[model samples]
Target: MSPRIPLIFNSRSWNWAVFAVLSCSLFSGCALLPRPRGLARFPKGTPATKAKLEQVKPGMTVAQVEAIFGSPGHTSKGSSHDNPPFLSWTNEDLTAAIIMFENGRVTQRMNAGGLK
Candidate 1:
């Protein structure tokens, strides 16, 4: 009877040890799981105002263009090859688009989905 009791106790303890190890391994695996990507910083939606589409004539400066159409949605320095350096503007919704000259004039303009 004494020997049987010891055997049973040992079996129970071994089962508990196995359970603990499996639980720890599962929890650690979850920690190693990959995280999802973050959302875009810019707001998302269609352009509320109609896009203005017009030819951008040469010699327009940056400021003058902004005056006619208000401020641009976003602006950045022109690329190395883009001549007559300018900044681009898009509507708040990012649908409408325009480009202004470095001197503050409208060099190019396109409306609703015109520029890709």
Candidate 2:
């Protein structure tokens, strides 16, 4: 009886192996990676300081919040069901400033790491 050749030695199998490797490398580059979500090291706008964050009120408008915290480092567009549009700010110290907006007004505010 003749022995069967290994599957990897077949041309079809070899092509699939090369395709898989190229696919992985193509998608793994930094160009396809999401940007780092953090505060700008040197902010060109208003800084997210403890004092500024304190001024954010639940009823404030988006413009009002922006006035206090400046442009957010990250802005997430939320859905209507459970999520709402939100803004985020961060600092070099890893302190995070987040604000949720509903109907274009502030609905929630969260601070983690306690900005100083």
Quick one: best lDDT, which candidate? Answer: 2
Top TM-score: which candidate number? Answer: 2
Q: Where does candidate 2 clash, by residue pair?
A: none
Task: State every prediction's TM-score relative to the real structure.
Answer: 0.36, 0.51
Positional deviation of 97 in candidate 1, in angstroms?
1.7
lDDT by residue for model 1 (1-116), tens:
45534566468568556644653454356446664568432344332234333434566655445554454444444664344454444443334443534444454443433343
Q: Candidate 2 — what's its lDDT? A: 0.63
How close to the true structure is residue 94 of candidate 1, measured as C-alpha lDDT? 37
Regions of candidate 2 where Cα sits further than 4 Å from its true position: 1-45, 71-84
lDDT of 2 by residue, 1-116 (tens): 99987677667658546744543454344235556677444355444677877899998987787777767553435565334577667654446677777788887676655667
Q: Itemize residue pairs with steric clashes in candidate 1.
A: 60-105, 61-103, 61-104, 61-105, 62-103, 62-104, 62-105, 63-104, 64-104
Query: What does the lDDT read for residue 107 in candidate 2?
Result: 74
